[model samples]
Target: MIDWLHPSVLLMLGMLPLIWLRGRARQIWQVTLPAIILGLITTLAAGSQLSLSFMGLELTPLRVDKLSLVFAYVIGIILIIGNIFALQVEDRAQHIAAGLYGASALGVVLAGDLVTLYVFWEIMMIASVWLIWRRKTPIAYEAGMRYLLVHALGGMLLFVGVIGYYLATGSVAFEKIDVDGWAFWLILIAFLINAAVPPLHAWLPDAYPEATVTGTVFLSALTTKTAVYTLMRGYPGLELLLWLGVAMTLYGVIYATLINDIRRLLSYHIISQVGYMVAGVGMGTALALNGTAAHAFTHILYKALLLMGAGAVLQMTGRSRMSDLGGLYRYMPMTFLLYMVGALSISAFPLFSGFVSKTMIVEAAAVDYRGVVYLLMLLAACGTFLSTGLKLPYFTFFGKDSGLRPKEPPINMQIAMGIAAALCFLIGIFPGALYAILPFPVDYNAYTLSHLLKELQLLFFVGLGFVVVIRYAGGKDYIALDVDWLYRGPGRRLVIHTRNMIAEANHDVRAEFMRFLAKLQTRLGKAHLDGSLLRTWATGSMALWTALVLALVLVLTLGT
Candidate 1:
């Protein structure tokens, strides 16, 4: 019903035909041009909004605010970058899925009402699974199915929560509300699931590495960040989030440390990155909220950059397991450089994007007097430095030489990495550009002497620890147990066992019935052979036969 909502609708419709665009050039334009136009429109009229009413429900399809604008900007920008990264891909399905997936994310942030938000939420879920599925390997197919199954469960939770909310309050607008009962908690669980908060998080690390190279980039950037945006919008200051966020940070680092595959390790690292943002939302101060928004923006860029670098290695060498890869720095030095930028940024090294943004949240936790929480956040930061910043890059690019040579990836791919790498530095050096657009005003300085020295010392010690233990710190190629083991391991065995028991019981019942039938047939044949069935009714004989027949009927009817 919103007039300017027309552009988003039209853009999404435009993507449908991309499924048939087989030519590489057409794919590029199809994926990138609409994103460019949408980005332009968003910048030019960043404050525009439109709303409509139907059946006593209010809907705002193109709501624009500072929070929505930041999320919209990233998804729009990433669309172009992601497609450029995927430019040489002949798979039209990836292009279509990426376009619609980006559209749904943009729609989610812009939607001012629950109806609009939930509709797009479901669309986003369905579209993303295709990206994994289109990888077209057995692993990809199975991972995609599991991914779908999990999100579908989340969607059902959201559906129930939304309906219960509207029924309880007679309002369906997507705004902050008191957690009165089942409605709020149900919806919260759904968001946490999407955000990859701990027990619910296995789906992300499980499925992302299985996606197409470019698809994983989009996957890493969009879904979890959308949850961050929504949580900031609707659930800031919720106390429970503090514990959940910290748990994710620590849990992710532990798994990421033990993970062997490069992309899979990075996938686990995402839970750590998102933890900072979620904890920021929980802190509920202006500084913390602003930091969450800033981190989300910067995280998207660097995380995508990391994935792009990993994808480059995967593409060139056809190997992603670090044990099978090394010494590629000599062959693909540009990749090494771009990848290190991402690593440094994510590690929150001084003067990189992450240091500038992530410091704000840790500061917020301190200012709020959440000292224990602050300590945990600090510990998680150290773990991040150990795993992502040190171990991943070392094993992939600089560690043991596996004697495999791989060239730099395609120009478009390199350009994508370069652009992302540039933004990581750009935001770090010029924090004001990112700060200016935050929903809250920013006054924090990240580069003051104490802050810089503190961050450097932390990184230094973590790096030293890694160096001292390098001989014993190699990645093991064994699966690390996680919450998914319940379903995929023991839970699966339980279901199969229950099914087998039921099958065995059914077989026994059938066998008993067949045996009874066989016995009856044998008795009838014997009776016929002896001609007892043609008994003459002599008085005593008839009386005795009738008495036997009555007893048999009684046994069959009651005694048995």
Candidate 2:
């Protein structure tokens, strides 16, 4: 029955019982559900469709194809791993939110029509906000509100686009939508917002680090990757995305280098790494598209692994800033070693997952003769190694001891990290395994000597430069201003200033009106006292005035 049912329904309905379950039963159910989802995902064949009619429209809630299948497979895998990692957490609501969040992502990828996609898209926004709010901190609450507002705006754009598209074309198919009209542009902007493209990306780093430790893992795995999936499905080869992706690759790393929060640092790199997939989608070649899918899959794994490591640090020490963490390798050696695997994988180190996948995008750019794009990607990769591989780990685990000695995270967490790290290495060592699942055939090799040497040499120089600048590379206790600063800083002040100005103007107007009323009252009092008008006028005089006014009105009306 689970296999026959849509994954979204199974996950949404299945997670509710978790609220009533306790202890081991909750843990067992949490882990069992994702496993069941994975099994169901495997059973799903491409071209499978499940549809029903609603409001005279056919809504396909389950539509399986190569593209959707790969995304579903990865989502299912991350859910199982994430649920295992979260076994020790006591909050059932967090688990439920994560489950619904994941179910919403599954719904988006499997949706066969714009209506189904939009429905899931909105649910994803609603469910994910709870993960941030679950932290119950003021900062988390504020961040979650901003996150919700941004996503809500995006959802509105998506809704408008879908409505416009349906009205114009009389179809709701969620397929390749070109950028020829307002509807397409609205849909594309909506996707870009979810993709965390810069100017629209502050919500990610602002909200993700504030989430519950385990919650960040799920947050890292889902939202942007889902956006990438939508882009790959709907807007591949859009030249604008190619340039925007290239800029994001650099913009993210630049900020990442300045970040002190370990999770926040990793969060910026998400934008950086996702830029690769976005670039590949922009290139629009078969090779580029395959590379995009591969990189997205691998990114979810290694990024989650990195966040798990950072979460472990936060859980044990109550500190997430690298300036507050150092010399932790001795106390958390397993954590250190496991986190390094993720670091290397994200850095595109040889025999790592990123080397297999990330290089594909760079290679795609080179093949397309995108010289500027290729060089920028390489530069971004160097920053990735410098910040993530060398800077973050060095400051967190290897730099001067901050006098904090914390033990490793729980066994289930270590197991989850181990599983993800192992998968990263395995996928790197055997690229064919990941490549086999791609929507396109593989004609690429990640291990060619030239490619290997080029990557190694790049990493080598980056490592050397980091060693030279080691003192300057450590985290500092300062906030780095980002695009969000515009709204959080000046934009907020502008609103307050405008509000104050309006209040002042209102006060001035009210005071002036009262003065005018008082003046009129005084004048009337003067007339009454002086017996100049009403007091002095006889009844005959008043009646004669009224009769003359009436006679004038009657004469004017007769003449007209």
What TM-score does each of the candidates earn? 0.88, 0.90
Candidate 2 positional error at 381, Å: 0.7
| Clashes by residue pair, model 1 | none
Put down candidate 1 lDDT per residue, 1-560, tens digits, no spaces. 23464455766877766766567657667656766646554653456677899777888877787888888777777777888898888887788888888888888988888888899989999999999998899999998998898999999999999998898888888888565899998899889999999889999989999999989999999999999988998899988887788888888888898888899999998999899999999878899999999999999999999999999999999999877887788999999999999999988998789998899999999888989988898898898888878887888888999898988999999999999999999899998999988888888999899998999999999999999999777777787877887888888899999999999999999999989977876887877665455445689988998999999999999965
The most accurate candidate by lDDT is 2
Q: Which pairs of residues collide in candidate 2?
A: none
Weakest 10 consecutive residues of candidate 2 by summed lDDT = 527-536
lDDT of 2 by residue, 1-560 (tens): 33358988988999989979999999999999999988888889888888888998888888898999889999999999899999999998899999999999999999999999999999999999999999989999999998999999999999999998888788888889953689999999999999999989999999999999999999999999999999999999999999999999999999999999999999999999999999899999989999999999999999999999999999999999999889999999999999999999999998999999999999999998889999999999999999989999999998898999788999999999999999999999988889988998989998999998999999999999999989888898998988888878999899999999999999999999989977876888877665344345788988999999999999999999
**Would you give me the overall lDDT of model 1?**
0.87
Task: Indicate the residue-level lDDT of 416 in model 2.
Answer: 98
Alpha-carbon deviation at 243 in model 1, angstroms = 1.5
Q: Residue 170 lDDT in model 1?
A: 89
